[model samples]
Target: MPRPLDRCHQHLLAALVVRLPPSLAALFFAALFLAFPALASAHEVGLSRGDFVVEGASVNGEITFAQRELATFLPGLDRDRDDTLSEKELTDAHDRIERAVIDRIQVLGDGSACPGRLLFALPVEGDGVTLKATFSCSAPPGEVRFEVGLIEDLAFNHRQLLRVGGGPRVSEALLYRKRKTLTAPIAAAVVARPSAPAASASLPSAPTPAPEESAPSTALDLFLMGIEHILLGIDHLVFLFGLVLLGGRLRAILLVVTAFTVAHSITLALATLGIWTPSPRLIEPAIALSIAYVGVENLYIKDAEGRWRITLPFGLIHGFGFAGALQEIGLPRAEVPKALLCFNLGVEAGQLAVLAVWLPLLAFARRRGWLTPRVVRLTSVLIVLAGVAWFVERVFGA
Candidate 1:
């Protein structure tokens, strides 16, 4: 009886040894290393705002950038080396800060450059500094172009939200390192357009060109933003990867994915629309805990039964994480629905794209007998460690 049981155990172990291609394991580990920073750094990106007002040929505006980011460009501002800028440090370095801001941001009127003059620099209530500047143009501006170069040499991802105002309407554009320039017709030009004649007026007039459309609803932009958010969010990606690593059939995979989709979508919309918002200090750590739970659970569960049950509730917590990012973009009230729809769709699209590639690779591994019990256990251990690290960092960092 002892010999028979030993033989049975050996057979079971052999069956679990899926002969996965060596390259696949290497690829997986490489990807994991690449994403480690995301798991470690809770605040992976910084956001700034630029508000521009165009009056005749002169332009004036305020640019608000996070002090942490500014420290990278102007290290002298952090005089005490305490990793934060003091009021006196900021005041003493006012000239250097002003010059840095002027060199990075530009406003062009018509074909000529509008030289910028820094008027004042002050620290905002939070971790931000506001710089006021005025622009002088050669002629009354018509088509205005805004360019931001603040991201150069920065270690982390940075975004600038630009709000341009002149006439009755205000238009917004999001700026990143790669796409730093935004061109729009000045609201002043739109206000200058002559009124259309009534049908009773006989003179044939050139069809009044429709008022230059305000930046068309940026649905595509919102979609891309969603994808970027997920990709940059290493913790989120790791959680998804843990789900995939568990190995499941198509039907089970779809069930789990659908549950996650529906669940996160609910809270994401609710929180973004100002329905109910949980504190980030709470939501972030909860998300990290969820990741750890999935990984640790994978070590014990031999089957995918009731996996969707885990995904559904955890998905709700992840939704709040997504909402925090979208809120930072400051979606306009009227564009909320469209932005919300596109952003959510984009996240789903990104999730599917990842699964589309990863699932097939995993399937091949499983068929080839690469996923041995030992391999699965090892992967789960790594995932759990990552989650714990993130949880500690986020909680203590908060």
Candidate 2:
């Protein structure tokens, strides 16, 4: 064999040769998610959730939202104007906050008004606010009607995940401003579903819906959530684009994407199940770093020869990032496995959808002789810059 130094020199010289380019269309899609911070964890400010148990004539529920999100209703909630909420700040806005929250939510029992009381409005960890309320109905709990309308005050993409259970009826709804109601029938349920698996875990995780709106089952809800998440998670998309920038054989591309999928699926389960959860503060920056690193590597590597090796660890990091979002969506203890399974499936489906879009465009470019190393270099530079920017903002900014 040749001397070691000679082999090293040959390898270095080989890396200088030009490689084929990835589609520019993929880069355009990659840059889009960052432009819209409302979609991902820009400030973790876009989504809120509620959990309710309708038992007998009593319906107890708690709703949570980001502190910045609640600021839409009372601009002064954060008196210091910091993104965080202080205990005193919450105490001072007690009455107004309670009124604002409870007014937006209406709980009905068989078409009769169920007068409600705000039990407590307290600050939860992670710069969030939670308001607990109990409604006592004049009528029996035969018919439970719930309506949530926070979207009018919040961003249009802002979603409210509502999960309600009464007797044998358990329904979970992913709600938008347009879809702000959930109505379901139930026998008198004494035990709460969140705490107890009285409702079969075999049933779709927390099922419920708005009247005549054709609500998705919890599985479909999580699947759609996964797809929406990947589409909106610009950094993740950019990283995927970077991995394929060298424009290698189809087998090589599939291998790299498959490695990412398997690696992330493992961690998504671990973090979502409470096995281990690293902070988003750490995970977010790491995700950005992955994107930057991949872009840099693509500039030097002439082919996607060993990309699968690197994407494995980075995909693990990205899985934790995905978990942060799912937790915000709120998983019921009883339906944890179902939620986890459906969510992961949704994520895989989303990944497949993205690959589907990107590969076809690349194929067309190849056929037209439009793909070139120049396009790859330009796109890689942009990706590296974007990743570095996100890393800085996530690490230093709020």
Candidate 3:
């Protein structure tokens, strides 16, 4: 018989031979998952076009926000230990929040971007707090589409839901223009537009009354949202990818995905609907750590059955991270069921989309006999790298 070292070397050689096919497939998937962030960076939420034109008249609009708890925002400066803020504290707090908000804003059209002046004078006062803002954008002469979203990170003690309502009113207007003829003759012609310019109308103003803080929305929505969140969410997606690499049958993959889905959905519903809540400071770190766990596990484990047993439990912690968005969005009062259903449905849609696009490619590669043990080993290493990246970023807040 050969010596122990020789046997080990032989095994290493075998492993090396198996690596290429899976490595290629795994690398391809990694590139696919990365496309999301690239796309997201391009279509960021915010108002881009400076001025919208409505048939020669420029359009103008403004927005304002007020927040309470002006004092607790600063720590060291709160010398009195009183909950209310002093002048020094107020200025400091506002300055910090304002800067945070401004930094998130991206100006569109014009190359130059600058923080607009804060119109602190439009003071709207609420219980123990007062604030206001006024901004205007003009539209040049012509018909155009206008788009805007709340991109500012406004400060508040609790998260608030913002409601956006607007619809265009279809109306017709006649205009004459000089038409070019085939004979090169300039003739005045009147054209009747088929689609009327339905001006998008928005309500003037409304008070944001304190919310009743109802229970969470429908179970379906909560569940679906959890699915969607996991799919698009890069951290969770990376973890799922590791789970996928274990080379399980369709049933096996479903079992693992179902386990993760059920676990996270449970916590997501509970937390978002107000039954239970986890601190962001804690949840964020754990989420990162979960990625590392999956990565490290991939490096050691080669069997499918063993991995599912581990995936089920780790998936529970991931649910809390999914609940983060719903917590912020809050369940809609009148349409709680609808809100929950839609949100969850959106999540499921996203998850299915990812699976639909990637799974077939995976199947094809497997059919080609690409998922050999060597490929698995290389894939595991890549997962480990991704998980380490996530862990470091989260733990250090990088």
Candidate 4:
């Protein structure tokens, strides 16, 4: 068997023979190598969690937000200028953090806006800072509306996992974009209990309702959400673009796409159902690496032979990435199957739509001689560069 380095050289020579001019390819590789030092920043998506309970005329809750997210609201929170935050740093800025949290999160009860009073602010063991607060309404509210505006101006992709409950009725939602307010009705009146001792931030215990009583996400909502997620996810789209850059016949294209769909579907279901889940911190960088691998492979592998080998494993990684989004948003345990099915269907629809538009344009380019071998090589190089940038950003950049 050929040594790994020998195999790599062979692949490079094969790739050059098929498409890339040797001189141009060498120059492109040299440029990327020189620019590697500057690509050390990491990229991340903003996320927060909120759990609220309604009792009588009072709404009490805790919102756990990342320390980095809190820095966006109050820059001074990170006193040492380091990217990482410590407990001492959070304690020093307790008042400012509390004010910011209270100002941004609003709860409306029975059409009247309830004033939020901060109870305590504590830094959790992780990179999270939890703020406990209460909202006092005029009377016992039959319905409550929650609005979370924290980090909205700072991060466009910021999302909040919200869980609200009173009595036996619990509702969960992912808050993003204009879908900030979540309104749910209380199933029964809950009598107010004595306040816990100062410095105690225990969450109120509410019994879980029967599966039938849980508010499940509608099939249409999940379907549309899936479609929207694919359209908005830039990384996933870039990966797909890399796949398309590997020119092939319609049958080959279908086979590659099918492999990706099937692979991701299996992982998506497993991750969504809590059967298996990998941390996003690891998955995100791996995904970028996959994109880089595909782009590099395209440089040498011209035919569709064993292409499914590439798509299958990478598709599994991509599926975990999809699961991260769903996990962040959360799914009702009772409706997991329906939500999973609809969301997967929507993803397929979106992927097909993208291919439908892309394939014909590629064919047109080929027919017109606009897509020369040189152009193909240049495009592949660019894809590789992008993947490298993302990998660096996700792995090291903050």
Candidate 5:
């Protein structure tokens, strides 16, 4: 028969591997709330006359995805399984789903002008995992327009442009007339251009006009955006939680947080500044594995042994992940340093904030001897289990 200690370890591990106790759940939810930040309005929708610019006439619209449909697609993603989507899951799922959006958008006239053959792939605002494109006749300038809603069969409408996945669906199939635009002088001029006598039209004009270029995204915004991103990032928070669980004293927690802060900041700067770059596909799974590693280390090691050893090294990897958030926002060269500093600062602020709340509690627990060998062992085992769960999910999620 297994020894009592062995049985205890196994049982605790099992619990953590599957799910945490209700008590831990409260802490986890609290951490989730503080860590990931979001605004009621998450996505930006508008038009730009000058290559991704904010034209005089800009329209901001929001898209909502069906929570029930996404739950069916990625089961684990449904955090509550309540047939509803929470903010965090919606944010986490943004990248994968946003890729399917159709960028085949065309702007017909100049500033304050009508648009022609407009096509856009818009993300479902709440769902985070769904996308849809609206293909409609060009609207003249100064027309009030609404989010055309999800288009079910973009393939039939713009078969040439619809290359990948099917976009989101509208509740019902309805054909609404496109908005009519009050053409600008430039538009009227183009329209009046004698249609180049049918005979002269023989020489096909440039097959398709060059697409308007994507506008530049700022580094400051990107950096702050990174802060906003990490705050909303679930996997990243999971990794930080593992770190907090290990450091039981205020001093130790400070040392660990500092070491992590310094180390990750270096790497984040290097990667974001283009001094270095790593594939996210590789970094993401590895990040999940890193969480598992610490959890496993916590289970067996019992305490941090030395200064600037494990924490700093692991912190370096975490910094890379932080840099990835910067990458997602696309920082500009002129703003590289500022973006790097602010982003790293935001990351450190987050780590410091977590330490502030957790360290004191841990210290009190230790002083009271509540962090007994049994409890420490249990905490370690549970952490390892959570790490393992993340590892499996990330690996298989591919």
Candidate 6:
């Protein structure tokens, strides 16, 4: 087994890899050139930011958010169908956009409703489409609660980082789908009343438990986000399917899966930690490339022998792909490590769930002699076709 495998690797290296079937190569190369533009964009994280100042019943703020995100809520804004919200398009739809923005985010002053109004909308660089707005309440708030409705409509993994300034130190929170409200306690100095100093001691104690509660909630939400991301990632799933579809010894599948997990985990941690990050444009096309590579590779190898080597490099790319999806590039440093850890864990759990169902079914088919070379060939061809289509879409669509 070892000798034959070694010879196969030698042959692969010598020929610079055997020529792919001519038909497959022709279609892939043709589409690749046509979709070359898509390599310009990478997967971005689902993140946004808002800075608010509270002063005596009035809260005014500016939020920098992903245009694509807002597009999810108001897709019609993409008028050109380019998957982007352009400046002209946004400016043209100013009234509708403004109303939509201010209406979705609510500000509550000391539990009293604060009416919100959009002041302006500006399209910024990258995915940032900025909105400046104000909210008015009956009285100055001792505590300000910001409720973001964006999360409910955006992707499950979306998080909005909020800065509420009425305190000695600005209070911030990362709000997700499950945790949409951020209650920022206004410092006594900012929202002053003469008796605040005397009552401050007790007031501080009341909100002290918040940090404790936040950690768990944040972790759980991120974990679920990771799961949703993996499950919804058609590209990632297709690649995974290519890896294990050949159904072989359980041990071999485990090894291949482990290799992929470790590689992606390393990159995921590194990218999330800001240690090393890859370009967004490079990631999506490369991911498509990985799927194509695997589909072609599976056409030759019947078993999982030496498959880890192939999965390893691509796994690293996959990690960047995962992080790229997070575009959490602007997320708080303090929360990143926790989010990375929990999200990675959730991804692994989701990966296992998928394998648990598929592997056994494949094993059952193998035992029944239902697994045949013809089926594998057809599946591989289909994977190759899908990879080509995705590569073109990501490039041209970007």
> For residues 1-398, could you state the per-residue lDDT of candidate 2 as single tens digits?
11234877667634533332245545544554353333335324256778877766778777877666687558877888666777677767777876777777888888887877666566665446777677788745787888776567677667777777664546767777778888868675454333222222122222322323324575687677677777766778878878876778888898999899999888888877877888777898898888889989988998777779998999899988877645654455555677678767877888899889898887788678776777777778778877877887776665
User: Per-residue lDDT for 158-243 in model 6, tens only?
Assistant: 77767677655566666887678888887664553222121111111111111323446556767876776677666787789889
> What are the Cα lDDT values of the candidates?
0.69, 0.70, 0.43, 0.70, 0.44, 0.70
Against the true structure, candidate 2 has what lDDT? 0.70
List the RMSD of every prediction in angstroms.
Answer: 11.8, 10.6, 14.7, 8.0, 13.5, 11.5
Write the number of the candidate with greater TM-score, choosing between 2 and 4. Answer: 2
Question: Model 1, residue 247: displacement in angstroms?
Answer: 2.5
Better of 2 and 3 by lDDT: 2
TM-score of 5: 0.51
Worst 10 residues of 1 by lDDT: 199-208
**Candidate 5 ranges beyond 4 A from true positions:** 1-113, 116-227, 246-249
Q: Estimate, for each residue in 1-398, the C-alpha lDDT of model 3 and write its tens digit.
A: 11234888768746755664555755745643442322211101111111111221212222322222222233453556543344445455555544443223332212222223332312221112222222222422122222122222222112222221111221111101111010101112212212222221222222222223422432342344445444546666666677777666778777777787677667756665667777655676666666667766766765456455777777677766655544433333343444445555665566667777767876787789876666666666666655555555445532
- Which predicted model would earn the best TM-score? 2
State every prediction's TM-score relative to the real structure: 0.73, 0.78, 0.52, 0.74, 0.51, 0.72
Candidate 5 positional error at 324, Å:
2.0
Off by over 4 Å in 4: 1-49, 64-92, 120-131, 149-154, 157-163, 167-179, 195-222, 272-276, 325-345
**On lDDT, who's better, 4 or 5?**
4
lDDT of 5 by residue, 290-346 (tens): 766876777765455453478788778867766653343333354356556655666
lDDT of 4 by residue, 187-304 (tens): 6667876553336544333223433443455456567667766776666776787787756877888888899999999998988798888866788789888877877887887756
Error of 3 at 111 (Å): 29
What lDDT score is found at residue 368 in candidate 2? 83
Query: What's the candidate order when arranged by decreasing TM-score?
Result: 2, 4, 1, 6, 3, 5
Among all windows of 10 consecutive residues in model 5, the one with the lowest summed lDDT is 158-167
